[model samples]
Target: MMQTRRKKLSEWVQQLYFIGPSLFFFSLIVLIPFVMGMYYAFTNWNGVSNEVTWVGLDNFVTIFTGDENFANSFGFTVRFTITAVVLTNAVGFGLALLLTRSIRTKNALRTIFFLPNVIGGLLLGFIWQFIFIKGFSAVGDATGIGFFNLPWLGDAQTGFWGIVIVSVWQGAGYLMVIYIAGLINIPSELMEAADIDGANFVQKLKNIIIPLIMPAVTVCLFLTISNSFKVFDVVYSLTRGGPYKSTEPVTMDIYFEAFTNNRMGLGAAKALIFFLIVAAITLIQVVITKRKEVQS
Candidate 1:
């Protein structure tokens, strides 16, 4: 019994050795801040001040009742997330399908497509900003194509679409890599069986390829949804939550509330609400998609 206890203690020590740093940092960085943020959410603590007064639920009440910016930003985030998730996954899957075919230039094409994803979101947004504001104009003048001549970031509608386009352009390539991995994992025997059964391309895609790739689909959708919902760097670099704050997402709203307006408590409340909404939505998505994966 003493030897067994010593062995168990040694095992425990080894486990701690492996997990100690991760647990320590997670507690220091995420867990503690999360709890403190919750506390701040219930108070009126303007950041950088020592005095914190309890305001109960007033901050949340005011947000739900009177904060137009929060509502608008929430709407913007939802729309952008939905649009980006759909377009990014669809384009990524399509590219994966095309490139998985026997082709001579696919390697080069894959590299070209994935190159944009290598750049940081802020830098990519800045690059696209210049293209939208200047390069598009130059191209328009030379080619006289009205599609390229529209004001890309001059208004709310254009600004929203601009964000979507930028997200899809930068995101699809990364997702394509994931889909390519999924495609390559599919057994050759399954494709041979489908061909023997006289399945058409669309039929095979619907019946076999898609179902088999559901795990990758779930991962890509979750990633796109989270990234799109939490979008800030791109929005900051590209449009700075303009024109007239039409492009602001919930993250930017929280940032301005905390830093710009110096209402840290209210910002914390907004952030907590944002976290809940995002968590719920992503959880639901994962649950549903996981179920589909099991069924498939």
Candidate 2:
């Protein structure tokens, strides 16, 4: 018994040796701040002063009753998330299908398509801002193209579509990689059998490919939903939630509330609420997609 106890203790020590550093950093960077943010959510701290007054649910109350901007931001976020998720996944799957074909330039094409995702969102936004403002106008003037001449980032409608285009361009490539992984793992014999059975491309895709790739679908949907919902850097650099705050997302709203307005406590409250909403939505999405997943 004594020997067994010593062995158990040694095993635990080994486990802790591997995990202790990660746990310590996680607590320092994430866990502690999260707990403190929760505490501050109930207070009336202005983010600068040391004086923090407890205000109970006043922050939440104000949000529910008087926070039109937050509500509008949230609504826009939902719309954006839906649109971005569908387009990103659709484009990604299409690219994956095209790239998986027996073509000489497939490898180079994959690299080119995925290159956009490597750039940072902030930098991409700024780059695209210049392109929309200057490059498009030059193209419009040179080619007499009305589409290129339209103000891509000057107004709310164009700004929304502009952000969407950038997001889809950046995200679709990463998702294509995931879908390609799923596609390559599918057994070749299955396709051969389907061909022997005289199954058309649409029939095989609907009955076999999609069902088998449901796991990748789940992952892609979860990523697109969460990323779209939490998008900030791109919007911050590109639109700045401008044109009378029409394209503002929930994250920008929270940022402005906390940092710009000096309402740290209120910002904390908003952050907590936003966290809960995002958590719930992602959870529900995962659950739904998980049910659709099939074992190949």
Candidate 3:
């Protein structure tokens, strides 16, 4: 019994040696900050001020009940999340399907499609900003049509669409890569057997491909949903939540509350709430998708 206990102790010591550094870093970076943020969420911390006073649930109440902008930002975030999730997944899956085929230019096309995702969001925003501001007018003049000349970032609806367009363009490629992995993982023999059984393309896709790739769909959906909810850089660079805060999303709102308005406590509260909302959404999605995956 003494020998056995010594062996187990030695094994545990070895394991701890390997894990100690990572645990230390994790505690410093994530755990500590999370605990501090949670604590500060209930206080009135003006960020730079030396004094922080406990304010209880005042920030929460203010955000949900008093602040009109918070509600507006929340509404905008919901709308953007829904639209972005749908469009990003649809386009991504479509690209995956296209690139999965054996074509001469498949590799080049894949590279081209994925290139946008590699670009920085802020840079992409600036590029699109130029397009909306200058390139659109040039197209309008050349085509003798006013379609491209509309004030994209200057109007509320147009700014919202502009954000969506940039988001879809930037994200679709990454999601496509995920979908491609899922698509390629499906057994070719299954598809061949389906074809042998006189299964048409649509029938094979609906019955075989969709079900088999349900896991990929779930991953893509989760990524898109989370990304859409937390989108900040692109919106900030492009519109700055302008046109009367029409395009302001939740993340942007939280950022402004924290830094610009110097309301760290309120901002922290908003962030906690945002985190909860995203966590709940992701959990629900995971549950539903995992069920579908099991059924498939």
Candidate that would win on TM-score: 2
lDDT of 1 by residue, 58-152 (tens): 99999999999999999999899989999999999999999999999999999998998989989989999999999999999999999788889
lDDT by residue (1-296, candidate 3, tens digit) is 99999999999999999999999999999999999999889999999988999999999998888899989999999999999999999999999999999888989999999999999989999999999999998999899887898899999999999999999999999999999999999999999999899999999989989899999988999999999999999999999999999999999999999999999999999999999999999999988998888453
lDDT by residue for model 2 (1-296), tens:
99999999999999999999999999999999999999999999989999999999999999999999999999989989999999999999999999999999999999999999999999999999999999999999999989999888889888999999999999999999999999998899999999999999999999989999999999999999999999999999999998789999999998999899999999999999999999999999899988888854
Worst 10 residues of 3 by lDDT: 287-296
Residue 49, candidate 1: alpha-carbon lDDT: 89
Per-model TM values vs. the true structure: 0.97, 0.98, 0.96
Of candidate 2, the 10-residue stretch with the lowest lDDT total is 287-296
Clashing pairs in 2: none
Best by lDDT: 2
Question: Could you give me the TM-score of model 1 versus the true structure?
Answer: 0.97
